[model samples]
Target chain A: MADFEPTIVAFCCHYCAYGAADLAGSMRLEYPTNIRVIRLPCTGKITPVFLLRAFEKGADGVYVAGCLEGDCHFIQGNLVAKPRVNYTKKLIQEVGLEPERLEMFNMSAAMGPRFAEVAREFTERIKNLGPSPLNKKNRNKTDKAA
Target chain B: MVIGERKPFDEIMRMAEGLKKIMVLGCGGCVTVCLTGGHDEVRVLSSQLRMARDKAGNPIEIIEKTIERQCDPEYVDQVESIVPEVDAVFSMACGAGVQFMAEKYTGKPVYPSLNTTFVGGSKKEGYYVERCQTCGECKLYYTGGICPIARCSKSLLNGPCGGSTKGKCEIDPDVDCAWQLIIDRLKSLGMMDRYEDIMPANDWRTNRDGGPRKMIREDFQR
Candidate 1:
């Protein structure tokens, strides 16, 4: 349990978070290796189904990172995503998972340091929470079947 | 269009507890437009069920299908061959669609995955509000298109009832008084004079009180 490695899925908008990640790499800012980022055209493209799918597929934590409020390239994409992400958080909590396991963040394209900071913060949060209960249950079932 | 919402995940899981295989049927009609039951919804629900079942050591198989409209016999018949292949059907359509499927195929267990909520329209993207009660008779012409039967907390016709205040209903401050909206619309349309005409009590026979109603068109009958 002390050395458990959690798998975190981050949906990043192309215009901001994705670019920030690239900038973070160029700047050699260190972030968690456990985070797997999926780039989307915009944060508005992030749906509740996508977030749920990540957990179903054994992700310990999931987050959507988009442009800062009122700064979406699509004008209101991040604004639309804000409520959807909050709704997904409530939904996951209802399904027995901790609402903290899912989150939403906003950052500008040039915020490489901020991107890395978020990655570290989110990774630490998930690490303290440990692996998702859904993942643990699946592992136990597989072990029993074997 | 009729609006519906998905049933709680726990209830759905309980219904499929003993089943090894099931078909999740999605409706492409009102349910699709409302974002509850549709092709994408069927896929999402199927995946979730599969994951939950897998974690329970039961590993159930889910078949996902969406028909044009579940209330129509033609669309319901299209899934005949697939129906027999699964142990049960989890219908994501409205109540009418679920009953239609059950009536078409007897003996097989059909469970509703959604609770049929209301006859409503989208107030905006992703927001829906009840607008009609399907009372066989429509009085929209007299009420400036606002439906008292559906919007009024007490379903009070000819009212800005004693409970109305500041254009809001007493039932909930957030809800607007239907009669207030009707009056406002009438005032804007210069039809305020019509408001003076008293409305008679609604005919209960034209509503569900008449018991399972149906409309038959003699001209379209084959």
Candidate 2:
């Protein structure tokens, strides 16, 4: 049996990634159910605080999937999202978590299979990393002492 | 906008580490426009600090407050009522605000949570690029409004250096060549002929070189 299912939060941009997810559903592509997707108007709107809030609320993994660069409905939205993701990764590292837990991907609405593929790949990666040390279901308060 | 970025979380945490309770002072002036040390950033920084502390088993108490302008003594004076209750303060303002907080609450240790980056202007949303050095004098009229002190990598006063490739800086590949931008702006404004004249090298004495600069406008003075 799988050791534990990671609770991953995927912030999908409405223009592309969210549409791609809908396409995945229509195509009947199977992927890990661990991911909980939140649709955002644009990936650029996702701030550093949202990423921190995700960890604070006990998400095992966080993913931001946006439209391909230059394809964002709102021009340069993906570009803005890129630096923010990089900055937040540093914050996560500073808080004693592996930076790899936070990931960003670029995909188009037509890439339904790619969405499922990314989900499965991220799920497997998190599994190998084990449950988030912050996941309260699998850990106690003393685990946070550093 | 006073463009700046928050200090590394761990580094900031270390600065405010031993305090049981601390006040976070946010600036509502330049930093507010830059989205660095404004009221919203203060709230988020305080929350993040609290969480980091809790995770580390430290569990600190943070009180967030914003002043209209931390650099002004009139605004900072308001903190006196709240200052006595906290063990320390984490100033989220610029270098000026941080120093003002330190001066206002003399006995308490004041820490800076943001790195004072530069005097700059916002480009498109969320993109702030340096635009001025606050030199005691203004020469923007001669350069068609672009500031050589801040934008140019070398702060070239006259024209684009020979090293400019395409329209990018030679020192850093990612930076747009400032001189190139100035020329474009001047040409668009039909002021290209004016840019042909060479500018004298900057006189550092008039800048902060003579020491921290100050100005008194008699016209605006009481």
Candidate 3:
């Protein structure tokens, strides 16, 4: 279990969270290397289907990082994303996955340290939760075929 | 539009438990507008089922299709070519759509994935409230455009029984008393005198008591 490295997918809004990630790199901030961020035009573009697809395609954990509340570049994109992320959390739970595996975070472009902090925290959470059950089964199938 | 809700996930899974391959049929009519049995829901449910089955190591192949209107034979006929290819069909439409699919493809098992809840319109986004009972009789004129038969807990024709208090139904305090709404609307319309007119015994035969009602237009028939 010590060697277990969970694969995490983070859907980051272009206006804030994505820029914060880039800034984190420029500032020499160190975050876990487990997460792969997919930049979105807005957090509003992150639908429940995308979240579920991420899990189905073997993401151990997923999160949406959007603009700070009332600071969305498109006015209410982050506001709308809040409820959608919450709903998808419930949906993943219904699919027999832990609701904690999916989450939503808010921050502005200047918060590079906060972005790194979130990445490390979420990666730690996923490591504790271990690999997704779907991923395990898929791996077992491939191993047998091999 | 008619309102429908998805059945519980476990219950739906059980319906297709042993099947290897199945078709998830979605409706594009009232159920689509209500967000229960539409193309989007079909994709969501299909993806969820695939993951669930994959996790269990008993993966099942799913075929997805959404017809224009499941209640119409012309639309259901569109799936005739694909019907025989699958072992069973999990219909996400209302009861009428499920039955129509079953009738069209006899010998093939058709299961309903949604429960036909009611004939109503959205009170707001994602919120639906019943407004009609399809009693085969139109009584909206007598009730100030509200249907007490559907909204009233007891479905009483001469309503606002002892159960009504302060415009709320006794059955559920949150529900507005149908008769109260009727009286209020009539008062605003200056037709309160119409309430004094007695309503005779309802003809139950016109409703479900008539058993499997149907309408046939001789002029429309070829």
TM-score of each: 0.90, 0.71, 0.94
Chain B TM-score for the candidates in order:
0.98, 0.92, 0.98
User: In every candidate, what fraction of the native interface contacts is reproduced?
Assistant: 0.19, 0.17, 0.42
Taking the tens digit of each residue's C-alpha lDDT, what string does model 2 give over A1-146?
A: 27788999999999999999999999999999999999999999988878877766677899999999999999989999999999888877777778899999999999999999999999999988877655364223322421
Query: Local error of candidate 2 at A27, Å?
Result: 6.0
- Across A2-111, the per-residue lDDT of candidate 1 in tens digits comes to 79888999999999999999999999999999899999999999887788778877789999999999899999999989898998887676566798999999999999
Candidate 3 structure quality by residue, lDDT tens digits, B1-222: 889999988888899899988999999999989988998888778877877887888877788899999999999999999989999999999999999999999999999999999999998867898988899998888989989789888888887899889999998899999999999999999998888888888998989999989999999999
Model 3 deviation from native, Cα RMSD in Å: 2.7
How far does residue B160 in candidate 1 sit from its true spot (Å)? 3.7
**Poorest 10 consecutive residues of model 1 chain B by lDDT?**
B50-59
Q: Candidate 3 on A46-92: residue-level lDDT in tens?
A: 77778887887778999999999999999999988888889888777
Query: Candidate 1: global Cα-lDDT?
Result: 0.89
By the TM-score metric, which is better: model 1 or model 2? 1
User: For residue B83, what is the lDDT in candidate 3?
Assistant: 89
Candidate number that wins on TM-score, 1 or 3: 3
Candidate 1 structure, TM-score to reference:
0.90
Could you list the iRMS of every candidate? 4.5, 5.5, 4.0
After the best TM-score superposition of candidate 2, give how far the Cα of residue B113 lies from its true spot, in angstroms.
2.0
DockQ for each numbered candidate: 0.29, 0.16, 0.43
Error of 3 at A139 (Å): 7.5
